[model samples]
Target: MKKKKNLKKIILILVASVSIFALIIFFCSFVMIYQDVKDNCLEAQKEYGDDCVDSLIKIVQSQSQTYRLKNSAIWTLGQLADKKALPFLYELDKSLLPQKKCDLDKYLCKYEVQKAIKWFQKGNITSWMYGNRESWH
Candidate 1:
């Protein structure tokens, strides 16, 4: 009887161990799936460009944990210049240097590059907010 009880306890422990390991595997798989979807969404926005208006809005509103990804999404939205992305762009612009590790000046200059591209695409020479040093505010 003693031996039988010990065997049952061992079996239960093994089952519990396997269950915990399986749960870990499942959790990792779920995270990978989530990342894949996120990457696909970003790529889709890049492919569709201005046509990705709704996608850009969705990305801006996404509860992503990564600041860089959120900022990149906002930058992509700004490139689209949908105006729907205005609030997010403004928020990202406001939070840009403080949250990111990169040099503030460099980051602002990068944003200017994108803005310049956007202005040129629209043929709006008067919309030169990028070169205005005071506009980083």
Candidate 2:
């Protein structure tokens, strides 16, 4: 009876450990996949030029897009550092600044727009690629 109980405890501990390890792997995979998509989008913009920028601008302008999607578009524009996007970005930055309190979804989008505008002004496209989020806000 003692041996059976100890075996069961060991098995339970092993199962729990495996489950946690699987979860960590799953999370890391998801992050890698997301980063790959972003990297691909940036590459596409570089290769395609105006077409990609136009599409990203449309995404930013689209009210139908979720805040996350819009924020992604804004970040991409910042990365591209195209002069054409500055007007639209300026408009967005100004619009977001009036709101003292942002809903959770809009807050990050607002921050991204602000960052993009700064990047445009400073012409710091390279650093924006590997930007440290802590210094921006």
Candidate 3:
């Protein structure tokens, strides 16, 4: 009888351990998927030029998707560094600011957008000029 009780307890503990590990893996898979999307979008931006901006803006404006994915889209938009995207980003940040309190992801997205705006307005030499030639156009 003593051995049976011990076996039952061990089995319960093992089952619980497996369940927790599975949950962790499932959560991590989603995290990986979001990162993959961010990377692919960045690649597309470079390859597609202005063609990808509309699709990216749609992703940012999408309310049905997870905020993590949306945040990734927001960051990619900033990296695109297009002046056309600036207005949409500003509208998004403005909308989020009025909330009682936004999450850290939202704050980061807003910061990234503002940083891109500054770079657009401020980066004159394109960094690759090496001080030899400067074109402001």
Candidate 4:
């Protein structure tokens, strides 16, 4: 009976150790992915220039298989939204992509353009505080 209890204890410890290891791996992967998304966002902003918003949207929409990538894409898109992208954003879907609108808008790849517009709207409110007050005069 004592031997059986010892074996069970060993098994339990092994399982716990494996679970902890898996958690550590998952957390490391998440951190790595987050950093990658941040880098991609910065790159999209810098390299794409006029195309950065569209490129970012495409990256987010295309990489929808991973929740981390998808979420980052959405966040990035929100950062770069523009009015020109709305029509395209409204058109995409999941069948063509993964996170489409109407479950289908994923096909349209202008997500960042749409998102950037929204960000612009919000940013515009603060613009008034910083710009030349003399310009109005």
Candidate 5:
């Protein structure tokens, strides 16, 4: 009986450890993806000038693009905080039903669009990586 308890405890510890490790890996991957998206946005702005905002908007609007790409573009728009993109953001927000649960596969980043809209509405832009808040208002 004591041996069975020990084995159960070991199994519980192992499962908890694996869960924590998996969470850490998931968050690390997410951070890397956000960084890459930010870099891509910066590079595009440098190469394309003001048109970069339009380009990102196009990506968000494109039905052919993957939801991941669309979400990245939505995040970039929030970071850019360009007033010109506000209308497009609003349109996107209006198009989606209120999400009771996050379904990125089905809704195509509806929550991200809402977040971007909130940033625009607040007239503030915050860096996703550095947490630097900039008031564009």
Candidate 6:
């Protein structure tokens, strides 16, 4: 009986440790993927100019994409600074506000939309991070 109990406990510990590691890995993947989406969108905006618009919009609308990725797409739209992007950026800004109160990850999303709108208004279109960055054009 004693040996059987020790074996059961060992099995339980192994299963628990595996479950915790798997959860950690899954959650970490989302964090990494979101950051990658943001960076890649920014790079594409910088490199492709107006050509990136359609693809970025698709990412924003795609069901598979996360809020973090959509937010990055919104920022890229703002950075791209095209008049065509105004409505999308504005819509994102409107949608983001309510989410802010419920989700902590939304602060960047809210900030990016507001900054995009501000730059869109100013006709400067720089990132909120540097405000008045050297023009990409």
TM-score of 1: 0.36
Candidate 3: C-alpha lDDT: 0.59
lDDT of 5 by residue, 1-137 (tens): 99999999999999999999999998887777656656756554554444667877777776786776677778788766778888998888888877777656555667888888887777642344533312111
Candidate 4 residues 1-137, lDDT tens each? 99999999999999999999999998786656445545655665554443545756665555444445454555544433445444544554323344344222433333433454456556632322322322221
TM-score, every prediction:
0.36, 0.51, 0.45, 0.43, 0.56, 0.47
Best by lDDT: 5
lDDT of 1: 0.50
Better of 4 and 5 by lDDT: 5
Report the C-alpha displacement of residue 96, candidate 1, in angstroms: 46
* Candidates in order: C-alpha RMSD to true structure: 16.5, 9.5, 12.6, 12.2, 7.4, 11.8
Q: Which ten-residue region of model 6 has the weakest summed lDDT? A: 125-134
What lDDT does the true structure give each of the candidates? 0.50, 0.67, 0.59, 0.51, 0.71, 0.64
TM-score of 4: 0.43
In model 3, the worst 10-residue window by lDDT is 128-137
- Look at candidate 6 and tell me the lDDT of residue 84: 73
- Report the C-alpha displacement of residue 93, candidate 3, in angstroms: 2.5
- Candidate 1 regions off by >4 Å? 50-137
> Model 3: what TM-score?
0.45
- Candidate 5 lands at a TM-score of 0.56
Which sections of candidate 4 miss by over 4 Å?
Answer: 49-55, 58-88, 94-137
Alpha-carbon deviation at 107 in model 5, angstroms:
2.9
Q: In candidate 3, which residue ranges exceed 4 Å CA deviation?
A: 1-38, 42-50, 98-109, 124-137
Candidate ordering by TM-score (highest first): 5, 2, 6, 3, 4, 1
Native-to-model Cα distance after best TM-score fit, residue 103 in candidate 1, in Å: 46
